[model samples]
Target: MNGQVNARAGASGKAGEKVLIADDEPNIVVSLEFMMKREGFHVLVARDGLGALEAIRREHPRLVLLDATMPGMTGFDVCEAVRSDVDTRDTRIVMLTAKGRETDKARGVGAGADAYVTKPFSTRDLVQTVKEMMARDAAE
Candidate 1:
């Protein structure tokens, strides 16, 4: 929570933020974990949606970067559940997925995601998205 990463597009993370990255893919999780940590945020990772929920419950991360598809519960389901929960309903959520269909974006939004980013995304985009969401959360 005390480092700085210069995201490729000149974006930077808000220091001391807590971010959770949930992905079934080990490499994606590791990569995001490293990137967020380097950007001065405390990072928590979960390999699946259930784990994601548990981590959120335990850590109450300020933000979550959730993968769309995963075992046990899809990210959509996680989003819906989180939105329905009083304690975490206001927590910032950004859905990350390879599915770029308009319907997929609609589904994520309908599930209460605050933001969305497609896979094969630019690191700069991800960092910028996270930073923006964090800023919005602070304003609220």
Candidate 2:
């Protein structure tokens, strides 16, 4: 219908959401950052739990994709820490890990994570989960 169609009309769509990707694996970080950016989310990377915490403080992202295992602080530890902090307590957290065991998922939820996605996952799944969390947050 036009050379350059700009049909989008929403404030949320214009600002774009910010998502922090915390993972010890460099490849995972790079891949997730690329995919999130392509999806129009501002992406921040943290290589460890400490780094994750720092990034959270600095970025104040709308959502966090946290890893279950890391050098200093595990995902559970990170989630717990974030939940305890008054400033970041409201931030949405999603555990991303290779640990697919039921116990691990339970642990993540117990630590204040909103969702859990196992490794070797499709980018579509990850993006969908993040969007769902954002939507749920908006409703709350």
Candidate 3:
């Protein structure tokens, strides 16, 4: 199904907790969606920052894998908006970006990302990080 499966309607994994994949790159989105689904997460996809924010509000995904650069709005902007909103503020955000500069990382965290992952990241590590973050959320 091109891996754009919107499992939001009836989630099928891990207590139906949702994980949104916010990336403009089709390949990245496809792979990440597939991996997240394999890891037992209900998946949602957004091609831009605006759509991501909308999904974050509507679906209330437990975690979001966000891209720093996106059309309509930047990931930093989306992160900041989510943080500012009381309803979506607690959503865990992991910035997945190609911009690995120290300043970029700082900006992402500053914008309220729970974690920042640079591009070319190992799939195993990314999955582990997502699991850890989701587990921590569950604990709290």
Best by lDDT: 3
List model 2 lDDT by residue over 1-140, tens digit each: 11111122223333437788888787987787777777777676777888888778766788999999987778899899999999999889989999999999999999999888888899888888887888887888
* lDDT score at residue 46, model 2, on the 0-100 scale: 77
Each candidate: what lDDT? Answer: 0.81, 0.80, 0.87
Off by over 4 Å in 3: 1-5, 8-16
In order of appearance, the predictions have TM-scores of 0.86, 0.85, 0.91
Specify the highest-TM-score model's number.
Answer: 3
Q: Which should have the higher lDDT, number 2 or number 3?
A: 3
Model 2 poorest 10 in a row by lDDT: 1-10
Clash pairs for candidate 2: none
For the record, the alpha-carbon RMSD of candidate 1 to the native fold, in angstroms, is 6.5
Write model 1 residue lDDT over 1-140, tens digit each, in one string.
11111122103445447788888887887778777877778777777788888777767788999999988889999999999999888778999999999999999999999988899888777988887878777787
Model 2 lDDT on a 0 to 1 scale: 0.80
lDDT of 3 by residue, 13-76 (tens): 7554789999999999888988888877888898888888888888888999999999888999
Candidate 1 vs candidate 3: which has greater TM-score?
A: 3
Colliding pairs, model 1: none
* Rank ordering of all candidates by lDDT, starting from the highest: 3, 1, 2
Model 1 TM-score is 0.86
lDDT of 3 at 137: 82
